[model samples]
Target: MISAKLLRVLAPKIARRYSSECAKDGFTVTVIGAAGGVGQPLSLLLKLNPAISELRLHDLVDVPGVTADLSHVETSCKMVFFTGTDHSEAICGADVVVVPAGVPRKPGMSRSDLFTTNAQVVYDFAVVMAKTNPGAIAIIITNPVNSVVPVVCEVLQKAGKLDPRKILGCSTLDSVRANVFLGEATNTDPKNAYVPVVGGHSGPTIIPLWSRSNPKLCLTNKKLASLTKRVQEAGTQVVKAKEGKGSATLSTAYAASRLTYCVLRAMKGETNIVESCYVASDIYPGLKYLATPLLLGKNGVEKNLGLGTINDEEKKLFCGAVEELQKDIKTGEEFVKSKNVK
Candidate 1:
């Protein structure tokens, strides 16, 4: 009884309403390497989220204990533990798979140094996820993320299921650090401050675009350089303060959890969701990947926001960062190629 003209206009709105209703039911999220420092806290935070109806924790060891610990928390979400060789079991129905596995960086060790060991660890896990949860979003938070992410992409590609949009490097920590440091410099509330940190996650390669800071505060070249250095070395600062016990586990866990939540909210088709992450892209033309502001939606990275603008001094830093990042990207790609040959 509906006219063709009216049907065309109303059909899209009706479909959108249906999709929104379906998203309210939430999705299953799996945390691989869920027993580590970052993983435990990240899981606890996710369990507290009403948007997650099911949570699965997987690790090579101690998952039962971690599961037991989290299961006690009174929440409607069902929690499951899968340990040892059952990694795939955890990922079976995952809407998102978060990886915070691999060894933590020791004092005097660079992120690149963690590459050899973490690459193998990440690749092994990526293989399982690619097979079991091929469509699920993969969030890589392992140390040396600049490389481990590439390893993940390569493994998924080999499995014939590479979707760049679904694979994201959790560079939110870098963004978090920039926000705090900028907040301190400008005497503003860190909670409300938003700073865009682009490029890779390690030293020299990390770039905090202060020019794009919201509620723009004028900063001199000297002050800007000092702030930039502080943001880049914030991780090392945490390591030194911890005095060789472990690297920035607690803060990193907090930052990773925030990112996981952002992805979950976006997948629920929540409007106006935006966050920055290191993702596979041609955004910078010659670069293999770059961390830039990302618009999140049901499909993960919906759009790669271009770098706004940079002053002369910032431009110089950007070029230097791109140069160093090239080495990191090459190292990751080469490691995967070498392993596949063997």
Candidate 2:
């Protein structure tokens, strides 16, 4: 048996190894809607991460309560709350700003239907971010993300602070779902499965690049089609499963946190880190924006990794997805233009 002194001597070495595994470099993360369903859990995950040294919780309401609750979880990170009309203080010095502050979709509601209500909310928050954390990498988790991301860019543009590299629509949930469903179908471990999901975040627009997936599992044409459909409709499945009480809040939080972890790791200069996110794109030549593979770095978006070789059937799906995505992009642009005119 090891003596207490020997155990103490080995503890620091163990911690260093663990930190290396977890990539624990200090980062300050601000969760804009810290009181909401996704925000609360996302914040908790960040706080638990040894990589994060500080967590700033901001919300229009209940921030203090949320901060108080999360602060009790014994962790290395310090928690700070900025509540009620003081949005600027919360984002003032953040390295990363996560916006999960919007309403959920109802049974009969399309994501676009939540636009009028969420647009102003996201726009107002974006304005604050422009002034305070202008250089921070902004991860947008609000619904109608295709539109909301454009709205964020427009807001930053109006402030003359738009940086295409710094804004991303958090579509990692779609990628996560794709991997999970594919794993379930193949009876493979989800952690080992690598799937790339592109396009917009809403129904019919999400494109899973099954052909480009690593480990290249062969699926019958029928099974492949079924898997693709399952990935696209996964959100609706969760909604129906919940019987209209809530959407995919918990799973979304998990996915968002995973994406945030990748970004944070990349921000610390960890090399070869790649993740898919919806950002201003030039990948498909004429397409204005897309969710594609990106190399994240300390300066944000080291490189926009374009799509790999896709099969003929996949190309057809890609074309259809881009068409729907263009409409989503236009809807966001129009919303911002109207807001500006008003």
Candidate 3:
């Protein structure tokens, strides 16, 4: 018998309660590259999501054992796996197709350094997904999001099924990091911190809008600069910390899972569910894609809540990021274009 106090202590946090908004059926989510470091844990997290009906895992490598492992977990979500060269069947009727299928950043590598390998990796997956599940929300978590997003969009365009709104580059990890950091620095509950990170998700391109955060802080200029750098280079920081072993697998999985639920909530008719994503948006002057907090609903991106209350320093961050983001986008687009010509 559990004590009432213990039960009170054991109750889930508010973020987890978002899953309560759904108890519906037939909401399948397909995770590509499901046997990889991020994919395995992300699949496990989504397995625990009561909102997800059927959880499908797809990868080049055989993942039946991984599926078997998760199937034994005491969760209502059904586990299914698709392995070795055929991914379309797994993605066919999924409500959301999440792509975390790409090479990761090593200690000396920048996210752009991953482009040549991951570009084709993501493009191939997006080709199948674009043809198979055009209506489903495509949440991209492949690195160099600024680039791969545009590459996926090109696939959809070529397929004649382009819906810019549904193609989202998963940038929620930036927001997750920003919120927790702000919460710790200001002694506020991280859940309530709610930081909106904008720009692209790479190096100088990732911008955490500290001035716009809820329950704001009055940090000195030095503190603000440090915090900004921390958020921007957090992935590199993780790679270094791990001594080149891995890059942000666990936290990336958790953040991607969080966004997955947000998409699910919208599909199940929940309102006011917002999360940041890098998408094909003309929000900025010179960039085609940018990460902004979007109000998610049934059709995906019900409304894009524009960046709010940016300070001068934040503006400088955006300016510095534009050229890099543009180049990344071009690299992705050119990769697909070159393939098409070949």
* Cα lDDT of model 2 by residue, 83-194, tens digit: 8866898888888999999888778887668887888878888888888888999999998888889888888888898899999899999988888876876788887788
lDDT of 2 at 36: 92
What TM-score do all the candidates reach, one by one? Answer: 0.91, 0.91, 0.94
Pull out the clashing pairs in model 1. none
Residue 66 accuracy (lDDT) in model 3: 85
lDDT of 1 by residue, 73-104 (tens): 66577899888865888887789989999888
Please estimate how well model 2 matches the true structure, expressed as its whole-model Cα lDDT.
Answer: 0.82
lDDT of every model, 2 decimals: 0.82, 0.82, 0.85
Better model by TM-score, 1 or 3? 3
lDDT by residue for model 3 (270-306), tens: 8899899998887878788889989998888888887
Q: What TM-score would candidate 1 get against the native?
A: 0.91
